[model samples]
Target: MTDQVEERVLSIFREKFHKPEVTIDSSFAELGIDSLDTIEALFEIEEEFGISIPDDAARSLNTFREVVAGVEKLLAEQRIANPPAAAGPDAAEEGR
Candidate 1:
């Protein structure tokens, strides 16, 4: 899940900042990403993940890892009730 989110985020950054070399550990400043661009990319991330990151939390993200971690945390919290079910007949039966 983290990998998936990271990939999506990287894609967003690539398109937003025109920096295809961005990596998981890349800091926004290191990638030449300004606050405005970061905010725009964060908006894109929210749209892609269907999650709302509070203003304070959004402001706190400085690196790719932070963004991915924040998204994963939000996703985990959101999925608490609808935790992913395993595949197969046994898993379905357990739900019942």
Candidate 2:
């Protein structure tokens, strides 16, 4: 799940910032990403992932890795109530 989110995020950054080599651990500060760009990036991420990151949470993001981590955590919690069921007849019986 984290990997998927990370990949999506990196892709977003590449398109938004025109930097194709961005990695999960890249430092936003070192990369020279400004506040407006960060906000735009967040917006794009929310739209792409179908998630709303609170303003407070968005403010705490300092690095690319943190952003990915935040998204990963949000996605994990969102799936808590929808765990996948096992396969086969026994699984169908358990759902009753």
Candidate 3:
């Protein structure tokens, strides 16, 4: 799941900047992406992953790893907020 998140996010930035060399360790400044670009990429990320990032949190994303971490954090919070429902007929038995 973490790999999925990182790949998706790295793709987003790469597409945004047309920089195929963008890696998890790449920093926004190093990539010549300013805050505006970061915010736009954040919008793309929110739409892609179905998550919301607050302005304060969005502003703190200075590196690609940070962006991935923030997205992971949001995803974790989402899982905690809305867990999957049990599906099997044995679900109740398992709970016991």
Candidate 4:
């Protein structure tokens, strides 16, 4: 999951900032990303992942790796809050 999210994040960085060389270790300062760009990128990420990132966490994400970790954490929390329902045989047995 982390790997997938990391890939998505890298893609976002490349598309949003027009920087193909961006990596997980790259900081916002290093990429010449400003506050507005960060906000725009966050919006894109939220839309892509269907998750809302809090302002505090969003602002604190200085590095690409931090963003990936934040996204992963949000996804985990979302899963815990809304776990998937039983399916197939298990669901049928439960309904019996």
- Among the numbered candidates, top TM-score falls to 4
lDDT of 2 by residue, 1-96 (tens): 767888999999988899987888787887788888999999999998878899999888988889998998777776564545664455689878
Query: What does candidate 1's lDDT look like per residue over 1-96, in tens digits?
Result: 777888998999988778889999899998788888889998998899889999999889899999999999899887774556775456689878
Alpha-carbon shift of residue 95 in model 1 (angstroms): 9.1
lDDT, model 4: 0.89
Candidate 2 Cα deviation (angstroms), residue 68 = 1.0
For model 2, give the 10-residue run with minimal summed lDDT. 81-90
- Candidates ranked by lDDT, best first? 3, 4, 1, 2
Per-model TM-score versus the true fold: 0.82, 0.80, 0.88, 0.89
How does residue 33 of candidate 4 score in lDDT?
94
In TM-score terms, candidate 1 sits at 0.82
Error of 2 at 45 (Å): 0.6
Residue pairs with clashing backbones, model 3: none
lDDT measured at residue 66 in model 1 versus the true structure, 0 to 100: 93
Off by over 4 Å in 2: 81-96
For model 3, residues 44-89, the per-residue Cα lDDT tens digits are 9999999999999988789999999999999999977776557444
Alpha carbon lDDT at 78, candidate 3? 90
Quote the positional error of residue 49 for candidate 4 in Å. 0.6
- Report lDDT (Cα) of residue 69, candidate 4: 93
